[model samples]
Target chain A: MREIFKQEIEQLGLDLVSMAEHMSSAIDKATTALEKADLTLAEQVIDADESIDEIEQRIDEQAVSLLARQQPVATDLRVVVTALRLSATLERMGDLARHVADVARGRYPEVAAAQGRSYDILLDMARQASKVGTQVVELLRTNDLALAASIESDDEVLDRLHEQSFQVVLDEDEDLTRQQIVDVVLLGRYLERFGDHGVSVARRISFLVTGDLTNAVAMVAETSPRNSETS
Target chain B: MREIFKQEIEQLGLDLVSMAEHMSSAIDKATTALEKADLTLAEQVIDADESIDEIEQRIDEQAVSLLARQQPVATDLRVVVTALRLSATLERMGDLARHVADVARGRYPEVAAAQGRSYDILLDMARQASKVGTQVVELLRTNDLALAASIESDDEVLDRLHEQSFQVVLDEDEDLTRQQIVDVVLLGRYLERFGDHGVSVARRISFLVTGDLTNAVAMVAETSPRNSETS
Candidate 1:
């Protein structure tokens, strides 16, 4: 019975890693679609989010089943519960990637970003978001604490880029239209939230590794930076 | 043993209702703060969120404890797991309310919503969101399937208000400043998501009362409408 439980737990981790990989791909493709105004790639990303959602549902069922069959206690129980929460976070990350694609699709013929600096800033934000997405996959696959710690700094980079995107709109000299300003605000927000959810995944993994209840509690308590106007 | 499990489950339901009450109050205060540009009230809502987070943590710990101590299976198991998920949703609702308050506080001394028609639309969104929040509390307390069903229509009202807000910004005649436009977009998104979370809670409750796995699975599958541009 113990051996079976161990195997089930390992399988749960692998399933989560697979979900993270799909999420990473969605982020990369969404970014490229945004950069090039590629309608086909954008449509593909939009279509693919359904599969990510389905994966999450499957993981959730498996986790619940494990809890029912094994009735894991203490550390083992925490692992199962954390898996459930982590899958939800990954699912939300997929949704954020899809939102990015929506912005790309919404401005199909016209790129969402303004020309020159604003465009460069958006591309930079997308790159940072994609980088964070990759790191999330690596952290999930290997359980590397250092990699998990690095996710926070990567998220900080994304936050800075998001702020700069806003600055580009707020700058009096930029001369962006209202539509461009709205797109920039919404896009920056979506990408920044993607990075934030990546940090959330890392924090949860670290708690699982360290068995720190404080970390688990703090992870959920931290507000997304953009949501807090003071940030 | 069965009686003890029953009582614990009842306690979990009551705890959720308490959390929903806090959430409902936060929504009411957040809307009032936005309408009146009341900085102190906004600050109150923001600070109160920490307590809401604490309540969620407590509820989670209790639910986990119930699972571990009782080793409940089948329907009993689903009850505890659903409690855990519902608390998370309620916690997020608190965060959304906090975000709304942040917007109000950030624009302190000046209203987040522009005057005239734009102002009315934002207030309407807030009121609808507050109504949904109240209905969530009622559903948690009474397990009323009809009330659960009503939340969807309330969310629709919020969606319409959100779109009207966008139209207010896009209308050439409105002449909203860039900052005002950004505020409107962010606020509308926040309120819409609040309504979405309320609908999620309602669906989960309905699933619990009806013992319908389809409702459980389908609830999370529904994407927030505004996230899809086609909506």
Candidate 2:
């Protein structure tokens, strides 16, 4: 019985990692579709998001059932439940990818790129976000506290890229309309928030393992817009 | 022991309601500050958000303890855990309010109105969102399935108002700089998403009471931007 329970929980972790992989690819394709105005890729990303949502729901149910059946106390319960919340965050990341695809699709046939836009910067932001996604799966697999904690540091680059993307758009003097400007703002916000959610999952996993969150609070300061508003 | 558990669970419901009340007011003051560009009120909202985050964390800790100690199964388990998730959502609403205040504070000395924007429509959207917050707390206290279900119907107006807020911004012919345009979009989105979280809580509470989610899915269609993009 003990072995079966242990295996089931391990499988739960695998499912979470699988979902993370799916979400990472979705964001990567989403940005590609956005940059190139590839309707086909955009549609694919949008259509594929259902799978992320489905997997997330499945992981949630599995966690709940584990809680109910095993009634695991202390560390085990935290592991199961925090996995559930992290899955929700991952699901949100997928939705942000979908939002980007939708914007790409909405501006199809027209170059969706803002005038004087930092196209490479935006692509780099997506890559960094996807990297964080990959690192999270590793964290889950290895329970590597060091890897989990590094997301905060890595996210610093993503935050700078996020701000730079906006600066690029804002500084442009040529043919930047209100709609395009709003889209750029949304794009920056989506990419930055993607990193923020990534940080949230990492911090959560680290806290789950070590019960330390000093780094998480500091990290949230850099990524969260609300936190930045006052300072 | 059984009776004590039931009462403790009931108290948990009350605690959630209290947190929701705090969130609703934060949003209220946030919008008022935005409209008046009242820096003090905006500062107040920003500073007070820590209390919301703190309460949410305390509630989370309490819920974990409830789950660990009660070892509740099935419906009882659902109640405790879902309450935890809802508190997270409610906490997010507070963040949205903070976002609003941040925008207000960021645009000091300026009126901070969306350019050629319908200020009343935006204010009305905030009111509707706060209304949903109040209703959800009531539903939690009463287990009023009817009240829970009504959020969908009531949200339709908020959705329309959300759409109109954007249309007014888009349709404007005045000199709306890119920054103003971006601010309007953010304002509309934050207000609309605020209500979406409220509906989510109401829908979940309904599901908690009677195990029906068909309504919840339909209701989300009106508010979630990702859902609208594909449809």
Candidate 3:
């Protein structure tokens, strides 16, 4: 029974890793689809989000089954429950990626980035967000302490870039239309929040590794900078 | 052992009820503060949020203890885990309420509501959101099927009101300032999401009673309208 539980735990981790991989791909493609105004790519990203949701449902069911069958205690139980929570976060990340795609799809035939600096900054922001997502998968797969620690810093980078994109949009000259300005606002906020959720995933992993939920919340609150006043 | 577990579960329900009550109060005061520009009321809401967080922590520790000590399986296991998830959502509802207060505090001496119609709409949204929050508490306490079924419909009301607030802010006919527009956007989004979390709690209760996760997500999706386009 113990060996069976171990195998189930291993399989759950592998499934989460695969789901995170899909999330990373969605982030990468969504931004590219936004930047290039590639309708097909954006459509593909939007279409792919269903799979992430499906993956979450799978992860959740398996976690519940483990809970029912094994009645895992202490850390083992926390791991199963955390798997449930983590899958929800990952699924939200996928939706955020899809929101990015939706922005791209909503503005097809025209890019959301109105300024050159905005365009450049958004690409960089999305790259950083995408990188952290992939890093989350790595952290989950290997439980590498150093890798999990770095995810927070990566989120900070994405946050900074998000702020820069906003500065670019809000300060745009007359060439940028109001609707386009709205689009940039939407895109930048989406990217910045993507970073926040990345940090949330890392925080969950930290709790899983350390068994300290309270401290994880505090650590994140202290380390992460706020850039509010956006819609 | 069974009766002891049952007693612990009942206590968990009571703690959640108290926490949800706090959340509902926060929502009420927050909207009033925003409309009246009442700094003291807003501060009260903000300061009260920490207690809600504390309640969630206590609930989490107790739930974890139950999971570890009792090793509850099947329905009992689902209930304990669902309590964990439900508390987190309830805490987030508290944060959303705090966010509404933050908006009010930030724009004190000047109402966060820029337009008369927008102000009225926001107040109504807050009332509806607060109503559903308390309704959720009752559902948890009683497992009332009627109350559980009604939350989704209440959320629909919030969605529509949120749409109205958006229309009012976005179509500001030269009367509203940019910052006020941003505040309305933020406030409206916060209220809408509060409603979403309310539905999530109801869904979890439904799942606890029926053990159907997929249908809950689908019910929320089919019933709730989308108002995305914001941060």
| Cα lDDT tens digits for candidate 2, B87-146 | 888888888888988888988877565555556677787778768767866876788878
Tens digit of lDDT per residue, candidate 3, span B19-87?
Answer: 988988888888778778999999999889878878887898899899888988877888888888888
Please give, for residues A1-231, the per-residue lDDT of candidate 2 as tens digits. 778779988888899888888888888888778778899999998889888877887788899888899898888888888888888888888888888888788889774654554666777777787788778778777878788769867888887887676666656464666566656666667777788888887788877878676754543333365543221
Question: Quality of candidate 1's docking, in CAPRI categories?
Answer: medium
Comparing 1 with 3 on TM-score, the higher-scoring candidate is 1
Question: Which residue pairs show backbone clashes in model 2?
Answer: none
What DockQ, between 0 and 1, does each candidate earn? Answer: 0.55, 0.47, 0.36
TM-score of 3: 0.90
List runs of model 1 lying over 4 Å from the truth: A226-231, B226-231
Which has the greatest DockQ?
A: 1
Docking class of 2: acceptable
Q: Which prediction has the highest lDDT against the true structure?
A: 1
lDDT of 1 by residue, B1-231 (tens): 889989988988888999999999999999999999999999999999988888888899999999889988888898899999999999889988999999899888998866667778988999998888888888888888999888866677888787788777777698677778778777777888898898888888888888888876777677466343322
True contacts kept of 1: 0.45
All candidates: CA RMSD (Å):
1.7, 2.6, 2.8
lDDT accuracy of residue B95 in candidate 2: 87
Which residue pairs of candidate 3 clash?
none
Q: Residues A114-179, candidate 1, lDDT per residue (tens digit)?
A: 576777888898888899889989998888989988897667788787778777777779877777
The CA root-mean-square deviation of candidate 1, after full C-alpha superposition on the true structure, stands at 1.7
